[model samples]
Target: MAEMVGIAFAFSYIGDAFHGSQIQPEVRTVQKDLQIAFHKAKFAGSNPLLRFSSRTDAGVTARMNVAVCVVKKSVWQKMGDLRFRRALNDHLKDVVVWAAEETSEDWNPRMASRRVYRFRLETMRQFNKPHDEGKLLEMMKLFEGTHDFTGYCRPEEGRITTRTVDYCKPWSIDGRLVGFEIAAQSFLWNQVRRIAWAMSEVALGTSSIEVIQEALGKGEQPPFFGLGPSKWLTLWAIEYEDISFTDKSGDFFENLSAPPVGINGRQFEIWQQSADHEQKQLLLNSWLSYL
Candidate 1:
């Protein structure tokens, strides 16, 4: 039996173009693109065992995500990390492979130390205002400890809804209710968005804090507050202990950064500029309704 090498890469993707991170038949996804790239590179057998640290839904962007794959040692040494990244990028569109490193075969991205997510809510509407910072902070605190998050997530058959949330809090950025940041080891499906929806209702005075408490205390699902729009949410970061990623040039990254080594950094800058321009135009269009 030939020895295998574990290859891990840090990647980012603009979610608008992808159906989701997971693979589905006849659907475009991050995983599907990556698998195709692997096949093209001849790095793995017909069916590669590619694994991702987090599964993002449609329209949910990610600043940093980790993926791990195992390939024959001979193949890795021959192609090298940098060349491998370049080959992968050649086949990817919205996804960028920024850094790579060697890892143990037993490593699993899902067992991450911490996972942080950000949910942004515009303050233009009454529902987005925080009625009382102190009171809202208190409500956010209720989610800090271990609790059955049955109310905050969609029910999955034979899956436990109980999970520990290390931190959950609302923060304002430049006087706007930017959104809430939540960190946990793992989360239930739609958990963060649903929590944000319930919190927004409380802030808007449409729902009471006691109602949230009742759901938390009773471990029961609350009436649908409505899942926040996926576009406003992002998987901000995933943390692992003592693992570092480096580019093919042997340049080590102190932290997970954007525009990975094989990618054209200027392209991302231009994309952001175009996105900002479009956003401003949309805001102006909305204002025209008032006139």
Candidate 2:
């Protein structure tokens, strides 16, 4: 019978595989693949739908990205079956459909209470030597509270360009690399990558915290600055409050049939990409040298 089941899957998609994350009739995407697999398995059609919490850039990777989809009870019941797991693995190999499970039918990946993202830095891309990551972390002082991240993203976003960052600080994953973990209820397109660029600016004495805040306060488009290769930004994790889960699965799901329409998110990512290319490449080169 038809039922709303919150199924979350953690996976990876090589940046080169498709034309970004959303499904387009003219192109392929992670969403398209998920839909295909479900369609082939007979669990998706008009009744069940899949939704993602965040959309990473074409070349970006995720360490803890999340998505939820409703599927037939029969498919949900078979989630633990070894063969089913293997079958999914076979179809999703390089894309990595690593985990799947039941969640509240009302689950929304975007509405999560908090999201943690890690920007992994690989030092010395050319000579392969590790630099003093400590020197690179002082810029983090500028990220501690709510600020207008407009300087870190594009101006074409259909919705409000301002956002609040719960916490952001830089740290060393090991002596080899320095990374920054940013936790926020939500982020704008290219926000994290650009902030990384600001950090790089600080390290080089090309800029300062005042510069960063001045930009944020002024709502300027992030100075054509973006960070290392998309590979470095990973969606570390997405968390939800336990109270958001409910026993009334059917009713809760029924309420999810239509997501609000007028306010469109993801509108600025397209423009942000063009400007990010050079910014990311410059940082990648410098970042590679850090190792």
Candidate 3:
């Protein structure tokens, strides 16, 4: 019997196309789709041959999520990373396997060095509340460094809510405040979404900084700011030690020109929706270009 090897790959998907990242019975999911694609590609291994670096909720797109699949060493040696990626993508639907590399047989994608998330604040305009840029950036900085994020996250049994945020800052595109970016070694479920909501509230003057301070002060009773919309959230990046995938997706960063201005009312709402779709398509196209 040939020994089994692991191949790690970076992929992107339109979250709207699936129920979520994890597998669920009687419903479509990223993992379920990957499993089917793997089978179609003739990759032989265990029933669940893949391990994901992170999990995302429904309607949450991912620019770069990683997974490792176990396959016969002989097959991998013959196919190579490029062919392996192409084969799986050939069977994938709405999922682009952009980059891949051979990995240790025991490699675990969950043990990542860092994870990054982005929350599109422009989506908040739908509420007719334009945020104060300075206030938004200020509130985001408060989450930096280590703290008990119990108030900013939905707690799960047997899970510690305390976590470290490496950095949190405003993410601008073409001089326009489009969103915020946050990075951490790991995060509690819904942590980023909750933080986004809190910052949005403070920036809009609907809530005060005191509320955020109280929430981060480790109080017995913490304040709640609600969850942000998942559709505008994306798992932007993940990093791992000793293994790296090249950014074969050509530079689309500079190509994202500043959005148009001077539009308002129902027409502006339509533009917002169209703008989001445009961004998603640009990302998808970039990844596909590597194939």
Candidate 4:
């Protein structure tokens, strides 16, 4: 049996590099490039094969994404020892495979571990205005532990609604919008997007905690269809206890210096000014509609 190799990438290469995460006949994709590189490198002097854990949308991103491939240990060492970042950039710069890690013949990226994601939202409209960060935190507290997130996500990551969410809560990010982190064994497609929309509604007082709580069920009349664009959700990390994220996923600036707080403030103000004055009045009155 051929040995399996696990690969990881940053999500920034979505629509620009390929059509999306999914591999299609007419377009380029992350997985395709990896396989292409392997073949081009003649890692085994044969066509290279690879697989991704989850297929992301056109614009989606990953901080610690994962992919798997198989090759002989000799070829694995040759490719693994190669300076992947410079090599890939020099030869196959189109798709930046900055890192690579070797795994046993039986390794599986998706089934062996959990995933972590971080999402940030900037209140760009009300740049300098103060937000009730405490209220946002309080509402997010409601997401902790196991709960039905069916209302907030698309039905593609998985069909089962009973997910044991290890972490769900919001924290301040720069003075703009709240940032939330989620860690779980896995996720369904668009799950984070749908949750972000619901959480944002709650923050703006447009929806209640009960609305989110009530929507957790997978029964008839599930949660609201996802809101907002899919650009904001970033797959921050993928885990497989069996495989060391560091060894398999490669280096992710996990310890970067603090982000620009000023940029967030400016973006927040911009987002606020973009809001309609009349619409604000209607939103104020319709606040009760969330009930």
Candidate 5:
């Protein structure tokens, strides 16, 4: 037995391709697929445990997510980091492992320094109500700093609903409102999505900014803001305090083709479904290039 070594790999995937990042029975997931690829590539040791840095929901894309896998030390040293990445990528589909490096055996992926998320309102049909950049910015600033996000998240039992948002701002491109970005050391479930719903409502005149203000105000009762669709959300990055991963994604992005095309209206419903998926890929690739 060649001792075991832990290697952390940074990867990205189209959210719609799998049920979610965690492993689940029957349905496919990012973790499950990665495990299968590891088996195929012989990258894992006996009963290896793989863990992800962040858990993203179904239909939510990730530009970068970290996961640690335990592999035989000799195998790792012989194959090296870049080759290890290729081994995984060669056996995976949709999910791309772009970077990898050796890390401490007990490395905890969840203890990240900061996690950044982005929600693209323009890509969501429900937020079609007219909105302007100025209004979006104004609505976004209210979320900055510490606030009780009770009304802005789907609370987990026994977990405190109060959380501090490091920063919140409108993410724009070419002078157009793309969506919003928010960062924190950690977040409650659906916190960013709920916040996006509130900001869009206020900017589009569906609700007043005061609704959000009241939600954050201490000792004040908050109202529930609707949850935004997961499809428009993306886990942009996860920063660590002590670990750094080298870029091993040479030509990976360059080799990616443009978004898939959708058929025109022969079967209106099918065409619309195809078009929706196409739009998501387009937006996802756009953000990927920006990274």
Candidate 6:
């Protein structure tokens, strides 16, 4: 049997068009697109098996995600890292391959050191009232330490619910967009969204801090607080030790560092442009209605 070689790569996706990161039969997904690109590039055989660091749900964008796959040694020698990225990008539309490197066969994305996810909340629309920053901060503190988040996540059989949260905090962006950042080694299904839901309730005065405390004490699912919309959430970054990646675009440092203003600042600028255009069109339509 021919020896197998491993390759690791990082990619980003808009996620609006994907059902999820995992491949599902009869549905479009990031994994499906990636597999097709691998085949088109001839980097892997027909049965290319790719493993991802994290599985993001529908409508959740990722700024940086990691994936690893093992292929025949001959294929790796032919394609190399640069050519593989270039060929993969040609077959992808919304997904872009930013970095690629060779790795040992035993290396996989599951060994990632840490993962960060950011949830953006439109407080003005969701709360319909002024937010209390102090109270929100108090709620955020509850999520920092080790806790059984069974109540804050969808239950899965044979899975442990107790997880350590390295950091969980809420901050304001431009005074309207509320951003919640969560960092951990891993997360349960729907964990971040549910935590955002509970915190929003506290900020809006619909629920008190004691409610979250009680849920933690019980270590069971809390009373229904609607899950935050998936569209506003993004997988911000994944971290790993002993691995250095060279950007395919040759702008590694510029892209890796957070901009001087911040990530939300850049996102808000894009959002505001679309919002302003829609507002102007609506005003024009209203004027035409009178005529």
Which predicted model would earn the best lDDT? 3
Where is model 2 more than 4 Å wrong at Cα?
45-48, 81-84, 122-135, 222-224, 243-291
Would you give me the overall lDDT of model 1? 0.72
Off by over 4 Å in 4: 1-17, 84-87, 123-131, 156-158, 171-178, 217-224, 246-291
Which of candidates 1 and 4 reaches a greater TM-score?
A: 1
Worst 10 residues of 4 by lDDT: 282-291
Q: State the lDDT at 77 in candidate 6.
A: 89
Q: Tens-digit lDDT track for model 1 on 1-291? A: 988888888777667678989999998999999998888866687779899999999878776788999988787888776787787887776777767778877678887888888775442133323365555667788888899998888888999999999998875544544567889999999998888778777777777788889989899877655797776677877778857542221111112122222324565456445543443344334322222
Output the lDDT of residue 156, model 5.
Answer: 75
Error of 4 at 181 (Å): 1.2
Q: How would you encode candidate 4's per-residue C-alpha lDDT over 122-181 as one tens digit per residue?
A: 432221333456666776666667766556556655477656778876644344344678
Candidate 5 weakest ten by summed lDDT: 250-259
Candidate 5 — which pairs collide? none
TM-score quality measure for candidate 5:
0.84
TM-score of 2: 0.71
RMSD of each: 10.2, 13.2, 2.1, 10.5, 5.1, 9.3
Better of 2 and 3 by lDDT: 3
Best by TM-score: 3
Question: How big is the positional error of residue 69 in model 1, measured in Å on the Cα after superposition?
Answer: 0.7
lDDT of 5 by residue, 1-291 (tens): 668878987888888889999999999999998888887887574356898899888988887899998777788898886788788788887787877778877888899988988887765443443456577788888888888877777777999887888998877655666678899988988888888877767777777777768767862435645878887788888888787652433222222222223323344445335545765565456434323
lDDT of 2 by residue, 1-291 (tens): 467667766554555465667777877787777666666655445434778878877667554456777666666786553443445555552354545667777767777898777764432131122234455665565666777776786555476877777877764433333457788888878778777767666555566667777787787754547655565576666767742222111111111111122322343333234333533444333222212
TM-score (all chains, Cα) for each model: 0.79, 0.71, 0.92, 0.72, 0.84, 0.80
Pick by lDDT: 5 or 6, better one: 5
Q: Candidate 5 at residue 169, lDDT?
A: 81
Separate clash counts for every candidate: 1, 11, 0, 19, 0, 1
